[model samples]
Target chain A: MWLDILDRGYRPGTKLLFALIRLLSGQPLPDAAKVVFYRPDFYGTRAKEFTHEAMRGPSAWSVGDRELMAAYVSQVNECAFCVGAHTATARQACHDASRVAAVLTDLDSAPIEEPLRATLRMLGRLTREGKAGAEDMRQVLAAGASPEQVKDALAVCAAFNVTNRLADAFGFERLTPQGYEAGARHLLKRGYR
Target chain B: MTGGHLPPVANKTEGIVPDEDDKQAAFRALADRVLNGEGQASARQRAGAFRNHGLAPPLAALIGKVADRPAQVTREDLAAARASGCTEDQLFELVICAAVGHSARLYEAGLSALAEATGEGSPGHVA
Candidate 1:
């Protein structure tokens, strides 16, 4: 009762963010409370709609770059939670899950193209060493990424750190393997994979 | 690098997401009763039994009535799942389908943050 009240006293600000987030994610507020709320960001779309945009925003920069960076960060956290979750999400994004799996598991033989692979290697160092520099990305640019792509790569890598930490710190409730598979499966059909 | 014959990125990769109608109905139900119907610590206790066990000492078996089952869920079942390292919400969120669109964005953003967190947060999966 106490937590429920605390959860429901929806005044606004960050609480609104979580409420909108939860609402958009499809698990809306419970029935009695759903409608009584003054204002909620329903987004007039399914949970996946908001997520699709959030997930793809990085690609406005580069494809393999974002997926690779997300996967890389999840792996860094050793978050059995986020690592597995994002691996599935990465699968939906079009990069081979096999490569993500291999990379996540600590293998160097990922199937990403040479340039992308170079980028991943650099990301690996950056994630492990604290930060990256212009020289760290020289190979990335040489491999084919532009200055913009280089910038986005860093952003994607940084974003993964934030998400992975959130998932790990909170001890994210997990889905069955079947559940994980279904996530990618659904995205594939809907076109956001 | 520019034109690496990487597989052409297509939007769709796999399954039939529920229709918008189903999704909306589900959202309404979700917002109203689903999450509130249960308790977090309670749900987590059963689901997190394995994790708790990983940290707690064992106790002798006791003869008693089985733990009461929630309207549909039972404690024993949750304990069993937890012992196997299962989780509840995030897993389900990862699986639920969205409308057929934005196929390209499935696991996109968040990389930068993840990497940053890994390095700053913990020793694993950082880069």
Candidate 2:
């Protein structure tokens, strides 16, 4: 939205990739993807790696949890683009889409376990305050999350903290509900690679 | 080498496996390069402008405002940065660097908290 380097101005490789994305999804590539595609070699590659490792990697936390965490961070950051995209992904990954709505409404009272809620709370604090101390970790642990789970969840939170800023800073365009669902499906199938 | 006490360790990765330690080191190195490396926007003063680490002036202002109060980022800000000769790609890279820096801070804080909770010698202490 801010910059003009969309499909027309992008490099040949990025333009080709965008064509593929459109072909596969039947919709234009979102601005979030465009920002990464603008810099395919350095920042884009690293961003993709971090996203895959944090959101799609093997972990005790389910994909739904990671996506929800990402959505929550974006919501807190007021990034509509990411909130839409990841909220859809979370809905797709979970059995009940209402849980995603509940989390967006109020994570503390959402119909989820205490451990996951605690993790979300910590991530919320991290997003707003940029710090989560030892007490936060102890709280998640007390709520029954293991160390590995905490690490994975924190990685998700951290990655989203980065991505939410990117989305806002670059002025990513808002997607329709259907568009978000389609983007989620693409991510679930193809991943960030 | 003599069978004697090791010298006082200075670097944090002295005892960790080289692969694991190098991975973290490489990430840190890359982050440093992104933020501090010479480029079109490198000549601008970065320190203390917006609580960001070593970003150009206009870029630090934009990224800092985006991170804290994104609503305040106006067309004037964008115009100023563009007028100051920052290319769109440079601005994009700066945003990514700033976001990654923010994430790294949170990640370090979370890991430190985990280390403290698990005690210094525990398995999760140094992640």
Q: What would the per-residue lDDT of candidate 1 be over residues A1-193, giving only the tens digit for each residue?
A: 1112224545667467657745665443322122223222221133223333334543444444465566676576464555655677677666566776766666467656666666667766665554454455566666776544544455455444434433332234456675565544543455331
Per-model TM-score versus the true fold:
0.43, 0.84
Worst 10 residues of 1 chain A by lDDT: A35-44
Docking class of 2: acceptable
CA shift at A109, candidate 1, in angstroms? Answer: 2.5
Model 1 residue B49 CA deviation in Å? 31
> Who wins the lDDT comparison?
2
Q: Which stretches of candidate 2 lie over 4 Å from their true place?
A: B1-33, B36-39, B43-59, B121-127
| Candidate 1 segments exceeding 4 Å error | A1-54, A58-65, A185-193, B1-127
